[model samples]
Target: MTNYNELTVPEATLIQKQLRDNIKVTPYNGPLNYIAGADISFNKFSTTVYAGIVVLEFPSLKPVGYSLVKKEVLFPYVPGFLAFREVPALMDAWTQLPVKPDILVVDGHGIAHPRRMGIATHFGVLTQQPTIGSAKKKLFGNYEEPGPEKGNYSPLTDRQGELLGYALRSKNKVKPIFVSPGHLVDVPGSLDILLRCIKGYRLPEPTRLAHNAVNQFRLNEISEGWTSLL
Candidate 1:
C-alpha cells in the first residue's frame, strides 16, 4: 500500500493514474454469502477519524459483525483524493471485524472519479476483495438523472462513452445514488447487489448501517471528551 500522507498532492495524483490501470472489472464468481460496508466520521475540531465496518448476511442483510476504530486523520481533504484521507483508518476497523466478507460496499465512488481511483477501488486493491461503491452523489462522469421509480438507472459514462458507473434509483420517488464497480466486480453485479441490499432506504443496508455506526462512535467520543493532539 502507498503511504498516502508521505506523498505530495502531485505524487498522489500520479499514483491514482497508475492504480487505475490495475483495476479489474470482473464479476465476483464466488458465493455471495456475506457483504460488508465501510464508512468514516470525524470528531469536531480535531483530526480524529472514526472508521466503521458492518458485515451482513447476504439477502437477509442482517448484521452479523461490526467493528469500529478511532485514529488520527493522516491526510487533508482533497477533491478526488478521499481514499488517502480515510482508507488507513478503515483498514484498522476492517481488521477488527470478526467475519470477513466476500464482498464490500463502500460509501464512496469506485471508477466514478476523474482518475477512477475512488476510495472503494483503493480499498479493494489493498484488501483483494470484490467491492462496490454506492455513493450518495455523483463525483464524475456524465449521465441523465435516473427515473424516480425504484431500480431505474442511467449509465454514467466518461467523455469517450466508456461506462464508469450508474445513476441508480434505490427507492421510488427518491433521488438516485451512484453505483460503480470497485474491483473484482462488474457494473451489473454492483447494481444487483445494491438493489438487493436496499430496504426502503435510499442507501443500501451495508453503507447505511456503517454510516450510522461511525457517526455514533464519533458522537460517543465527543461526548466523552476524548481528545488527542495527534
Candidate 2:
C-alpha cells in the first residue's frame, strides 16, 4: 500500500496526475452477479472498515451472500488524501470475502476529486476490479439540480469541464447522490448500475447497507465507550 505520509507534496501531486491521465473511462461488459459496497467509520482510538458483497441474480438485484470486517485504525484522517487512511482496512475486508465481487460500490468519490483518485479509484486499481463511486455529497464538481422525480439526473462536471458523473435522484423529493466512474466503467455506465441498484431508496442497496453496517458498528463501539476521531 502507498503511504500518504511518506510522499512529498510534489511526488503526491505527480502520482495523482498520473492516475487521472491513465484513468479508463469505458463501459463494462463483464459479469456483475456479485456487487459489493465498502465504507469506514473512525473513533479516537480506532477505525472500523466494512465491506459487504451481495450476489444479485444478474439484472434482478437479489442478495445472495454478504461479509464485513472491522479493524482498529492506525492512521489519521486527511482531506484530499483519504484513500491512504481508509483503503488499507477496506482491502483487508475485501480479501476476506469468499467470492470475488464483479462490481464494487464505494461510499466515496471516484473521479470527482481534486486528484481524480478517491477511495473507489484506489481500490479498483489495486484490486483490478470494476468499481463505482456513489457518494452522498459532492466532493468536487458542478451541476444543476435534478428533477424532483425519481430517475432524474444531471451531469456533474469538474472544474476543467470534464464529465465526471451524474447527480441522480433515486427517490422523489429526496436528496440526489453523486455517481462517478471508479474503474472499468464510464460515467453513463456508472449511472446505469446505480439506478438499477436503487430499490426505491435514496442510495443503492449495497452502499446503503454497507453505510448502515459501518455506522451501526461505530455506534456500538461508541456505546462501549470508544472515543470518535471522525
Candidate 3:
C-alpha cells in the first residue's frame, strides 16, 4: 500500500499519474447482493476525521450494517489529494465491517478528475473494490444540465471530449449528481446502480444514509466500529 501521509502535492500528483494505468474499466453485470456508501466528515479547523461506510440490501435498500471510525488525520487539506486525508480512517472502518458490499458509492469523484485519480478511484485501487463516485459537486468535467426530472442525465466529458462520467438529475427540481466509474466498473454500471438506489431524495439511499451516519457519529459521539442495523 502507498504511504498515506508524508507526501508533497507534486509527489501526490506523480502517484496519481502512475495509478491511472492500474485502473480497470469494465462493466459490472453480476447480481448484487449488497451495496454500500462511504463518506467522511471533519471540521475545517481540525485534523480529526469521521469516516463511515453504510451497507444496504440490494433492491430493497434496507440498512443492514455500518462501520464507523474516528481518527486524527495527519495530512493537510489539499484540493485534489483529499484521499490522503480521509482514506486512512475509511480503511480502518472498512476493516471493522462484518460483510463487504458488492459495490461502493463514494462521496467524491472517481475518474472524473484532472489525472483521472479521484478519492473513489484511489480507495478502490487500494481495496480492490468496485466503486462509483457520486459527488454533489463537479470537479473536472463539462456537461449540459440534465432535464428537470428524475432519471434525466447528460454525458460528462473532458476538454478533449473523452468520456469520463455522467451528470444525473437524481430528483425533480434538485441539482444533478455527478457519477463516475472508480475501478472494476464502467460508466453504464456506475449509473445503473446509483439510479436503482434513489429513493425520492437528491442523494441515493446508500450515500445519503452514509452521510447521515457519519454526521451522527461525529455529533452524537457514537462509537467507532461496526454497528449492525440488521
Candidate 4:
C-alpha cells in the first residue's frame, strides 16, 4: 500500500473530490455469494485488522469460510484521516483472502465526510469492489428520525443539499445505523443488503462478527500486557 501521507493537501483534496464525483450510484443486483466486513483494533503500538467473510447460500445468510489478519499499525490515528492509519492493515488482511467476497461492509463513513471520502470510500476506490459503509454514529449530515420500527429509514443529506445516504432502523426500537454506498452499490441497494443481513440485531451479522473478531484480538493484547502505542 502506498503512503497517502506523502500527498499534499491540494492533491489529496482533489483526489477525494474526483472519487466522490465519479462514484457509481447504480443499484447492486449481483450475486451474493459472500458478505464480508472489515474492522480494526489498535493498542498504542500495534493495530490488528480483522476481516470476516461469510459465504452465504445465496439469499440465505450462513457462514462458510472465515479468516483474520493482524499487523502493527504504521500510521497514527487522526480524525478524518482514519483510512491512512487503518487501510494498510485492512488491505493486508483483504489480500490474504483466498475467496474474495462479493460485497464488503465497512464500519465507517462513506460519502458523509468533510472531504466526501471516508475510509469506506477510500477502500472501495482502491479495490474497485462492491462496498457499503455502515456506521454506528453520524459523522456529518442532517436527517429526520426514522420511524419507530424496523426497516424504516430516512435520507441523510449534506450541507450543500446532497444526499449522502440513509439513517436506517435495522432493528425495532434500536439505534439506527448510517448506511452509504462505498462503491459499486447505491444507497438503496446498500440499505437493502443491510436489511437482508440483519437477523433481529442492531448490526448486520457480517459486521457484528467482524467487530467481535477484532475486539477479541484487542482483548488478547490487553491481557498480554502489550503496551499501547495509540
TM-score of each: 0.92, 0.84, 0.96, 0.84
Highest-TM-score candidate:
3
Candidate 4 Cα deviation (angstroms), residue 182: 0.2
Candidate 4 residue-wise lDDT, 1-230, digit = tens: 55664665556567677767766667888888778777776565544444333333335666554455666554556667677767776787677666677998888977777877888888888888888888999988999999989999999998877988999999999889999888888877888888888888898887786776667756663222111121
Instruction: Give the per-residue lDDT digits (tens) of candidate 2, residues 110-170.
Output: 8888878977887787788888999989988899999999999999998778899999998
Q: Can you write out model 3's per-residue Cα lDDT over 1-230, one digit (the tens) per residue?
A: 56667888889889888888889879887779899999998877887889999999998999998999889887897878878787888898888888899999999999998988899998898899999999999999899999998999999999999899999999999999999999899988899888999999999999999999999998976777898876
Identify the runs in model 4 with alpha carbons over 4 angstroms from their true place.
4-15, 18-22, 44-58, 220-230
Tens digit of per-residue lDDT, candidate 1, span 83-179: 9999998888877765679999999999899988999998898888889998988889999988889889999999999998899988998889999
**lDDT, residue 2, candidate 4:** 59
Candidate lDDT values, in order = 0.86, 0.75, 0.90, 0.74
**Clash tally, candidates in order:** 0, 5, 0, 4
Error of 4 at 54 (Å): 5.6
Candidates sorted on lDDT, descending:
3, 1, 2, 4
Worst 10 contiguous positions by lDDT, candidate 1 = 221-230
Q: Quote the lDDT for 38 in model 2.
A: 73
Candidate 3 Cα deviation (angstroms), residue 47: 0.8
**What is candidate 1's TM-score against the reference?**
0.92
For TM-score, candidate 2 versus 3, the one ahead is 3
